[model samples]
Target: MRLFIQLLGRFGVRLDGEEVPSIAWKRDRAAALIKLLAVSPQHRIHREQIMEAFWPDQDVELAGANLRKAIHFARRAMGTQDLITVTREIVAFADEVQLETDMERFEAAATQALRSGDPAECEAAADLYGGILLPDDRFLEWLDAPRERLQQLYAAVLRKGRLWRRLIALDPTDEEAQRALMQAALDAGNRGEAIRQFDQLRERLHAELGVGPSKASIELYERALALSGAEPASPAERIRASLAWALVHLQSGEFDKAAELARETRAQALGGGLAREVGEAGAVLGLTAHMQGRWPELFRSEFTEWVRSRDEFVPSVFDGHLCLAEFCLCDAKGHAAIARSAQELMCVAEDADSVAGRALAGLILGEIARCAGDLEEAETHLNEAERLHAGANALSGRVLVLERLAEIALARGQKWQASRLVQRALGDATQSWLSNHLLLRLQALAVRAATTPEKVEEAILTGDRLLTPGACQPCSMGLRIASAVALTQAGEMEQVDRRLNEAERIAGMWQGGPWAAALWEARGIQRQAQSNKVRALAAFAEAAARYEDLGRPLDQSRCLERMAAVMPAAGA
Candidate 1:
């Protein structure tokens, strides 16, 4: 009898290679009891201890009965009493029951990798221990010991090497932890983070330890500075090092670098026959492509391929489902089909116990509804996504939800609400490239609410600052449209024409898509302002056609209305 427990995403217990779904869904006590036993070092646990641990508030006899029921349910779920045998002396997991626990596997793998001097393996192993142990079972005494151990171990690993930055991110004041991270940053040649960590540690040590950093820490800092003297060393030291680098780059608005690193990481993982690594790399690549306005490439390279691939690999199946939903949201080629695809993706994501995945799926569903002109459905899904993000403390997810809400408000002509929502989004954009890009688009919408030329000019300047030359085409097009619109409102007809022409030229060089439709719509406005009714009509028609093709019925209708108003006789 082999007992397998996976707490990677949500939680699950399996016996003999078969997952016990009912234990996960219907019996909380059984699930909790199994988790407690699996995490315990002593496979044998006393019945008194179980009763006291779980039901300290209740009568001893009642607690004992409840424990028995839970044990019975657990045995039923396991489908064999051979795995868990009970005696009056004590209850113990059978030795024949070889337990496979993620926590144990992760710790063993990380320790072995560190001992063997395999940084990539160590990093991968560390990533497996993403959250602290039994994060959801915090109140249970049985879970506390293992959770603390895992937390300390994770902190130690972070301090030793920056395999997982999120550990330090939770508690920056841990000096010993900071020291470990400093060493890791130095080892990886990330001069910026290394220096940053050194300074932080110096301050923390002075405040907490009443002394400078340790000799070993100072030596590492000095070495890092020396290495950074001529040129910054490679961003990362190992193959799996790219994950940390990708996060850094993603936060720094270096989408191209993030995409390139993700691609390299995927190729390396595929070469190494690491299916999970390949899937993670592919997901990162797909996300980078989507953020960089390369949705077509994302769908073709990752989303389509993963969905068609075999499900023997868990990571591939999970990533494939997530990518499918994201692709459905962005791909403009088939709205109905993509919407159905997103629904299916949601089911898979839920099955995987992926909170982030489900939140993202809901967001994509909202986007699909928004594109199809179903603002009510869009709002429902967006609200659900927002709720999930809040529950999970997912900053990126919240940003996405807010941006979509702002777009919906703008489409509905709720200018004041749109402006307020966009302002909130701007405040929350932080350092993420996607958030910043969304902020710029929201600012463009807010410009419509500007009552004065000065305010319009301010919005234009804000939009201009966001359209840095290497930024995503979608973001650039948004800024161009906003600038053109603001200039037109300010009675700067000549400047409007110039900006519109530039936007048109850029859009022409790019392939036709939803982004291009925005640029063309801006050009249509400029033509209408110039009294070139024929060209204005043509431009609006083209913009509408593109929007319709992208499944954005609301935008298409807006373009059609503009064209109809301009060419009343034509009645487009």
Candidate 2:
């Protein structure tokens, strides 16, 4: 009977026609032993050598017994008693055992195919080659060199086959068995498969490897789809198509239209009752609302509803947690509520191994600390967030963390460090409009540290850019107040009053928050600089009142100190 050994795909072994799935084979020890024999030009291995190769650590007696057991299993699996003829002295394949391994067939076929110039032959060689031999079984040191050589040969054969397929497919007379073979070649990576087949392959590949198809394969398949005039019906395509329309509206700053399309996609996902899809769509909608400054609509209701509906919605938790963090920081009544929400989010993130979740949790902790006037603790948490963001390749997360760090640095009088961090934050915040406000505020602080008049003017210009009509309210207020401060320093009294009035009006609309307190304090400082003692005192008192109302006791005390500096000691 004919006997053979071959590698299945890359990591499996087959003896004759039977497969040996387990590494601990009772048969000829699969290719590992055969490989030892094949490499020994003498076509025979001394019993001691075979024992030493496989069971180097075992005693001679036990090793010999294991080798004999392997030989017995191999012979039985091969169905040929004479396949591996072994004596008491040595082991070798019988003369009747004609080895027909795929590697040998593939190499021989590849040489002939290259000489014949036949596309079909080239494709046949490629089909036989499959992938590298025993790629994942690296514990076998003897297989590595030969495996690498076979891999190179296989890659060459595949390249030749790919070229032949394209050439033959372009020529009608040449496209016979060549076309079918070429299709199979392209189908190795499932590149030329129909959309349904491709999707199936994608799902299978992801299940097996924990990754999607290579980018090259996906691009090639997309081109093939265009050639065949068949639209891909994959879920990725559906998601991308809807996302593209939503982004188009988003880019045009049409929040309503963006929100509508995003909502429709989210509803569709929810209707399908797929938790992952619902979470993905809900995240997109929540992000859209954040950019549109419609936080209440997205977080308080829409996001909460989505979170309550989905059982395994991870992204929804992140979105809801972030929204609550922002709400707590912006709303005096929401601090404890936000902290509770953040704790819940951290639990979910730790459970899911989510890097983004951990980073956001750190940021939330920092916000809580900052709100409590624990600047040192706030900086520590923000630093932790930055470190996590850096390790996880989360650019936007890093940007937010850096922005918070800059704010703390400025508060601590580390102006130079704050300036550098603010610049980095601005560059990273390019994708998020909400961050632009922060960028503007940082630029103003940097300018305050600059000794040159040019720097002050540049800061004023930055403030003007941030004060555009559609700017986010908090960001615009920050810029307006900063502009007032910059104008006062430039000795432009008229422009300072104009900017201060605008800032006060914007603050009135903004009610109480960290931003409102800052603006009021900025106006008071400008009045003090202008020698308007009464106005300065009144402005400082108003700022102190606003800070006290926002639960910022430290800021309230600082405002009172500034007021005392400007006013006389009445009772004393």
Candidate 3:
């Protein structure tokens, strides 16, 4: 008899590829008994040992009776009593009966792969794992140790060079995978790529966990530096670390902390005569300002300082133009400048063979395409950006790309696709070790807006969780508006005013780039909810104007359509 068993993800048994029904195992321990026997090294167990393992609480007589029932069920489930022999106090699988199992196959494949030193075999092992062993039975005391042992072995196989990428894809925050990637780059004699890898790891660590890399990771990085013939971290290195951390704050959406750190780093770098560091710090500040929608603040931004002293910074055109790109991308009215600056960065990135620079440049172009409602172009640029990010194993860039793709899918009216993408982004964020409050809150707005009516309440609750202070004000405005829309739909009219009040207050008080346009749209939603046709039309019109001023044709088109909806239909 060819008996096959599956013990990963869930446990099941098959005979010649035919499934065994639950009726055979039914609410009982038959399947578990069969699984225990199948994976045992001996494929035979003492009857008393089995009873003690499964029913330590029962008296010996009762335990013996239960064991008898278990044996009967196992035989029926397997469709062959000849395979199991219970003689006196001993029970064992027949020596002649051959058993096949995914677990043993997975382990055997992994062992063979290791013995042969083959990447393909390692990948096959990874595929065989599917998930941790017997995930449904993970909580059982007997299963925990074995499951962990197998999981560790599976992870080890996946950590082999090139295969580390698969390990990271499985768990973005996996320190072992992160360390291996950096080591791989250094071993390849690509100092720059190695440094980029460290930067990526640090950013992900700080953003996701509100902490820095572990001591072991720092040690690994020091090794990379030594291998690349770089001197111990100089003053320039200090400034680089500072700027890198600032970016962690920025990309994770902690606008205030990021801005503060960037400003300090820029000043420190300038004082120390580290022009490269100064430019890096300035660029970090610019991206921060861009995300916060503080347009006037952006113009008076550190990029201006970098621009003025561009001559002092060697080959300043690339850094200078990149800084310019960051500034232009921050401003709602600087759409033309975003294009001009992004193009400049793209040229520099390509000329220099800088993966990060290329990814960022492509991201800028993708965002611009999104603003234009050219989903096709946006997809093209974003895909290119993702490729660059993947090549470097840059987790932060990849997550941002995924979120942008989700937004594009939302714009295309593919709700299911959009939701899945957003969920994927959220999943990546979690696994990336990100202190993800802001990203989660910001994404909650998109999810809230796109969710089904049945799920509206859950999304609103998610929005309410963001009511605490210190959220990125610009993004917060959108979250507030989305919550209000959900509340209005659910007929929670009293809470709508509070939500709208907060959104309107942010729009009036903060210079949050296109967040202001979003606020206008939210006002229209609020007025419509109040059943005030005239006011809603006016609000939509105002929103349309703001979007037009912001150079966002897509948003402008959406606002204009809303205005049209309320106008002719309701006493135009």
Q: How close is candidate 3 to the true structure, as a TM-score?
A: 0.47
TM-score (all chains, Cα) for each model: 0.49, 0.48, 0.47
Residue 144, model 1: Cα distance from true site in angstroms:
64
lDDT of 2 by residue, 102-187 (tens): 66778788888877767788877767765546543332555657777766665555456665443322221232323344356455
- Per-prediction tally of clashes: 2, 3, 7
Which 10-residue window of candidate 1 scores lowest in summed lDDT? 317-326
**Candidate 2 worst ten-residue window by lDDT:** 168-177
Model 3 over residues 477-512: C-alpha lDDT tens digits?
556776676666665454566567777786786553
Candidate 1 local lDDT, 456-565, one digit each (tens): 76777666555543344444566677778667655455346556666777667555446678777877887787667888899899999988878788999999999879
* Model 3 steric clash pairs: 207-435, 208-433, 208-434, 208-435, 293-511, 293-512, 293-513
Q: If ranked by lDDT, best first, what sequence of candidates would result?
A: 3, 1, 2
**Residue runs of model 3 more than 4 Å from their true location after superposition:** 1-331, 431-434
TM-score, cand. 1 vs. native: 0.49
Q: Which numbered prediction scores highest in lDDT against the true structure? A: 3
| Cα-based lDDT for every prediction | 0.65, 0.60, 0.67
Q: Candidate 3: minimum summed lDDT over ten consecutive residues — where? A: 314-323
